[model samples]
Target chain A: MSKYAELFATESRDHLTAMEHALLELESAPADRSALDALFRSVHTLKGMGGAMGYGTVSTLSHAMESLLDRVRSGQESLTPPSIETLLQATDALASAVAASTTGRESALDISTLLTRLAVPAAPAQGTTRVLQIVLDPGTPLPGARAQLIVGRLARVAEIVRVEPDVAGMESAQFTGEFTVQLRSAEAIEVLGDAARAAGFVSSLVEVVPRDEVRQTPLSVDATWNTGDLQAPLQKYVRIESRRLDGLMDLVGELVTMRDRLQVVASRHGDPALDEAVAKAGRLIGELQDGVIGSRLVPVWQVFDRFPRVVREAARAAGKEAVLVVEGREIELDRSLLEQVADPLVHLLRNAVDHGIEPADARVRGGKAVEGRVLLMARRERNSVVVVVADDGRGVDRQRVLAKARRLGWVTDDTEMLSDDEVLRIIARPGFSTAEQVSEVSGRGVGIDAVLAKVRGLGGAVEFSSVEGKGTVFQLRLPVTLAIIPAIIAQVGAESYALPLTHISETVQPAAGALRRVQGRPVFVLRGQVLPLYSLRALVGAAGRDPEGQQIVIVEATDRRAAVLVDRLVGQQDIVVKSFDLVRGMSAGFSGAAILPDGTAALILDAGGLL
Target chain B: MSRQLLVVSVAETLYALPSELVREITTLPSQVTRLPGAEPSIRGLINVRGQLFPVMDLCHRLRGVPGNEAVDVLVVVSDGKTLGLLVDDVRDVIPMDEPAASVTAPDEADTSVVRGVGHSGEMVVIELDVPKLVRSSLA
Candidate 1:
């Protein structure tokens, strides 16, 4: 498919997702006019864009859906569950059609039947008139022609009650590039805006006087009031295909490699002129690469926006009173990473509502507020994004986890020896559920394992801290970008290896006296903590004995630290991670490979793999 | 006409590994860091060039001979980064004509390691299945 088709598909899918989420929210609070308006606006926008893209199927489907939303927003018809379900089905159909169009195939989905079912009975005309103030951005050129075009467009949707400045005086009046148009039709404000934008004069628009606001004002057709049409602003963001971004990243990697080669050549020949030129070029290239990659990062809010409705519906399904509070939604992360994290966040939110939050009666008895709060907060840390999903309800019962672990044979007779963190890790293990009964939502002993895997797959870490009666917070620490990592190159016997410095807890030169054997395992005492030592040589199957004296690199994986004994310490370097799987079979302990200075390959150690 | 053969002596027994499987040749480090709990065939890991790669002892893994010899050469052969096999010596890259394949095991040799016996004029060249050899060593 062509790139433009992909862009259209992405934009349409986003609009559909927004529409579905808003519909779900409106289902619970049928009287919420803002949500209804937002839902109507999304469908209206989709209809117009689909028409422009020549996706007739999408346009028709969205037009039918928009008509239904108009009736509901105008309070002529109440939102019922079946109505919401039909809307969702229509959304699903639109999404499928968009997907099909991008693949160069026509969608055969017919939503006319469902749309016909949502049609509201027309009410008798009672001579009620509504004024829609059209506001154009002052910077818009051809003001008079644009105004005429907007009026012509509105005539198709609603009867013109009155046009301010009286057509002839339109040019001389202090117009402020804004004009009011009184319409006699019962069409929704969103539909009106859609009609105006279709004419192509409205910019940065909103309905300042929403239906609810108009209802509050006791205006019987002759109400003299200032009503300005809010211009719908052009979308500030554009969706780019991930594959294209990945291709760009690959080119950048090649550029970095070439840069390194140039530096090496310049340094080896001791050419000051060449060195200075290469250095200058390298600095500029570095900034360009960073800026290019940074452009791909989107705020976490893009994903978080969908969670409010998810939480609302999930809470209702589980018969619980829960409120979802999101903070730091503006924290930017790589788009791919954000996509990867969405599922886990949804799972956590579902669990919070289904299991963590108590029902109203239970909450009242426990002296907690009836409305439980699940806060999903994200923030930027050094080189990582830390997201925490915290729920204010009954925290994880440690006793139950221990009991479950015992019953599942995950923990041995030496149960006390295992730390709380280890016990919590077991909870993330497959088929380990602490819920008393399997609930349809989450208690079936699934999702957590997948969540853990996804987080780890993104080169991130997940940790859980709980207070029995208070709540449970699952914190996820993820690298800001997956394209690069700061690594320390070390020698394991005769081979050099790179270990990501993020996972390196500390490096210690343990003397002979500091090494001791505990239970047949080598342990090194550093700062009063006994860290397990794994010799890199033995782990990698090198032939020969380890040198008598060697420095140990203490690395952290999951929540524990282990000392990796290496032959010698090579200097640290920022390495571009190249996938090991692409080459052949999975490397035993190496996460990836990177080319080092002086033009040689370095095997990057996988800390998680070592665990 | 005599067929050319690449020969390496492991514990005084002539063994030939196809030259195509050899990725590169490097000098053995002065000391190999030993991982205590690892399998016996896994001699240790070594830093070749600047990358730390796993080095498998072909002597212990293939021949079951544990020799502590100060070796000058280590053949760094790998399917990828995971399995880097260190051989005592990489003698030569030779071309051999098609020879009759017959099962003939050297004394105390595991049959799994030997593909077949091929005659290179006077010398019996043993064909090695590289992956199979590594798997058996790992097992």
Candidate 2:
């Protein structure tokens, strides 16, 4: 794979996320100076990265986005909600274009739709705002360098509102020996003329003013740049390929297992020096593993930062005013886990906006503030991270939801009044929607089941609590790392397997007579609950018969729980999850494989797939 | 122009893949872990110098026989992903004087996975379609 392609893809994604965040911020604050600066920088970086990677389509798309944001920054274009929506769409197009270029697949992504919208004339510049056109002498050695010198001198005298042929274009010498620099300064033409003359290399300078002589508001260039919002210094960082990091982590994973083996060996031998060395190695391996996993730990903000935009879009689509307040974004999570949950978090936000939050008038009539609030708060609780998406709007209508559930045959008429948890479980079922018809906002058939499935796949759990007419909160409890998860190792037949502890509700040795066959399916009854039983050996296609006393591990998925019968419970330990080649298309019901303490591989059972 | 091809034997049948596509050939890893739900063709994952890549059993793919071979593996870059092809044995790298002949049409069931068979002098080599094999197998 090309390193340039990887870098371009990653950098472009970061810029797009940042741009989307800033666009949402702009939508709320409109004239927030720092937000505008952030938007401009993100667009600028995207343009530079795309151009450098030879992705002309992506670079051109970024250029269009940059120009649009530039107009908004200069107050030449009104930053209306619709305009921001168009800009967000353009950002998405740029992201897709970059993804296409990196994947060695030509995308049919046409940016013409966005470009045409962007080309629509912006509002005319206010007042005497004029662009100073400077022509470098034909003999100038480096027009780009000379242009920078001229702009630097002018910035001291006036706010450099916008520069024609942005830094990347100028540095690449894409410009002719002449360029235009728009400036907002109170100084007269002659006074600003002196500063331009001092920079030299200027063959000539010309000023073009708008017909309207109303002086525009003074620019906030100083304040924005001084805040380091525009001129944020590049932090020192080494861009190590994540592949190399992953390789190192894999080696560390092996080391961790080997460390356990070494401990066992040392305990048996009991040699003083050997024990000392083994213990020291174990300590070092633990440190190394932590270091590797720590490197993959990224602040939740990386994913959380995107939610405001999602909430804004959902609010706009539903014609409601909902504010997303994210907390505990500083909490860090494994990079891979963070990426996996991003989609689910986005869906939850959309659900919160579309279903939980009411429109402004409705909310106001309910004696609440006109603007609804969607709180996305995350915090560390003991071992797992808890992310709650709570919306202070109209909560889920319990009566409507229960009626819908009964109609769909999800619940019988004889069923008792459902508890909050039971109601949530019902709503999360696939194809369960209380909405009368599918709307663009929330109902398109696929319900919260997809979200639960994803979270479960990542070894996480999703829980919800709601009160009618008040609010609803969807709580997602996720493991800190997807790479190494705490799993209960169970031995079935001659092979060992691991089931994520998160999926296991309880383990019990069902009495012989407790096992019953119903419709040719074996099930185990415990207390009052009867669970479908799966033979771990038979599932893995092992040649074996039922053991004398089968150990049943009760595992829970989204809507069902099953009893997984194993020969014996080996023990519990942290396992390094290694993904199967996805092309293997749903291999026997295994979620992933993990390295055992014995340095062998054991398939991690998918509790959800069992049922 | 002579084309250099890496000749590999799987289930008594010889196949020729472009040499450039073959990243390396190494002894089959002893601890190739079996995935639970993976297709039989995928013999699970093997860690080569700390990097884990999925091992594709060539015999399972070609002849529908389980590849129990403990021989050498040819690591090939197919569709930009590195995967191990479990070959019974890795034969010598040979040069063929002409482009692979198109006489042998791809199997009726799957058109793109196996390219036309080729004759390398006395050796009849089934030219393996790397991209198509990777795409179809992985998917």
Candidate 3:
């Protein structure tokens, strides 16, 4: 595809998505005028674009769909289920045609059936009158001829209800380039603008819509306003490829290392002037690093926008009624991290709709609304973003889950009651599900284990809870960013390792007797709790450590708190984490590799694995 | 096919790799963080500029002979990923007009890296498959 074709394809896909969304809304509320307006506007834009691109098939199909929507908007025809279905199918065909056009191929799709179904004549065109106030450039030759051409262009789309000047008056020299042409048509103002421009130079054209229509038109951000700014997005937002941003990030990291080296060199020189300049360089480099990282952040709405449709589809497939409520879409996160989290969120939402939400009959019998609700929310907590997927459906059947767990030997048969934590553990086991054993989940969707692995693989944690006869809630806590993070550096023997500050609760110097053995497992007594203690020597195979002074860092991960002992606390600083997965057969615990301030590399520790 | 070869030595055994795969050859950095539990052939990691690369002791890896005299590091890229091969000393680069002869010996332990042998003015040089060598070493 040419660069222009790529832009066209992307924009056409966006409009198609919007039309689908508006169709779903109309399906739920047929009387919703705003949804109808949005639907009409998107179809109108698609038609205009398709026509400009020379794709006759796409333009023709979109034009028919636009006519139908315009009829509904002007009170000529009401939206029916059959008409909505036809609109949806037509949108799909339009998308296919657009995609095919990008590859320089003609779409083989037979849109005749869809076009015929959409082109039924309206029952009488009631109250569809619009006035076009036209103006031509001043001191132009053949002004009367220009006026005639404008009227002739508009006469094709609408009935010539009225015209200000008679034929003689227009032909005579007394006629200025200004005139009013009142036409009756069920079309958007953009279509008329296109027709007017097709004739000759139109200096100015305004649609004087009826009084009620004007009030509902929403002068700002409505159909008419968006048409004026159709070319604005391309001129407004510069589209830089993501790989370029990644390259800039790498260069900034290199600059940071250079600044560190310069600072060391400046200190060795002991010259005051060079020292001041190096200090200033260091500050500027720090700010530049922050700016580069900030550029990689995008709002969560980019991922959240596609989820409502997912919920609706899943609900329809399961023969249930479910509505998705979203919150906190404006929160920002690392672009890569946000994208990686999208699939897991999709799985949880589908799971909630299929499992947590009861059927319409069950909901009605339970004294609840017939339409179930699933809430997806994102909120900032400390250095992490906590996302929640909750539904007001039948809660998990714990008895069935416990029986299945016992049968699989995941939990002991003699165990009477399993806590919420135990239940989550059992269900998230790799091969935990069966055709016979289902809680709220019917074991028909993506395995919960895969979801858990994906979230945890990104250095995130998951929380699960269910109350019988109520509903289920799943919380996924993820880091705001992964490429750069603040970490605590700890030394063991001659090796230095970084532990991210997100997982470290505090560091403590345990007293001589505070460290004791419980059942031969080393445990630290911190505030009356026996937290498991792991020594750096055993974990990383450090030859030996100083027994005289031992510092323990308390780490909390996946509901397990543990104390890790190291030789000494070196310091804390922000480090850029680089992907180290290229090295296969390496030990399983290290998360990534980062360059230290001293120009050496240190492995970043993984909390989920360590604890 | 004509090709440019970079020759290096590990424990007195000479080896030649395609020059196109070689990124650079430099002295081992002062700070090499030791990964204690890794394979015996795996020495540790080295930070070149700001990127961390896993440095392997080539002598111990291919010949089972420890690299006691190894000092130079050859940084090579394969499939967009990089690995550092630690060798003994700087060697010469040779231009060949003919391809190396394929060696298929049943007694060879590592067939991944040493797939053929070549000659350079009466001296024998083992032609190395850099991509397979990287994969075998990592595996």
The best candidate in terms of lDDT = 3
Counted clashes in each candidate structure: 28, 6, 0
Candidate 3 lDDT, A1-611, residue by residue in tens = 66556667778867988999999888656667889889999999989888877888889999999999888888777775446766876777777777666666654546676777789743224446667778888876798888888889998877778877866788898888888888887665567778987887788776543456535533221221222222322422345789998888888887776787688788999999999999999999999988987888877877897899899988998889999999998787889999999988998888888778888999999999999999999999988889989999897788888998888887777988877777787878877764454544335556778888888778788888899878988999888887777889998877899998877889998987889999999899998999998887688877864667879989886677899999889877777887653455666778787887678889888877775
How far residue A29's Cα lies from its native spot in candidate 1, in Å, is: 42
DockQ of each: 0.03, 0.46, 0.38
Model 1 CAPRI rating: incorrect
Better of 2 and 3 by DockQ: 2
| TM-score against native, each model | 0.56, 0.66, 0.69
Query: Model 2: which residue pairs collide?
Result: A127-A214, A583-B138, A587-B37, A587-B38, A588-B36, A588-B37
RMSD of 3: 14.7
Which ten-residue region of model 1 chain A has the weakest summed lDDT?
Answer: A221-230
Q: Which 10-residue window of candidate 3 chain A scores lowest in summed lDDT?
A: A219-228
Task: Give the top-scoring candidate (TM-score).
Answer: 3
- Which regions of candidate 2 deviate over 4 angstroms? A1-248, A364-369, A402-422, A444-446, A510-514, A517-521, A527-529, A557-561, A583-585, B36-42, B64-70, B97-101, B105-112
RMSD, every candidate, angstroms: 18.1, 14.1, 14.7
Off by over 4 Å in 1: A1-239, A414-419, A582-589, A597-600, B1-139
lDDT of 1 by residue, A531-584 (tens): 887988877666678886688998886687888999899777667766522222
| Local accuracy of candidate 1 as per-residue lDDT tens digits, B96-133 | 66444466665744567676666555766666666676
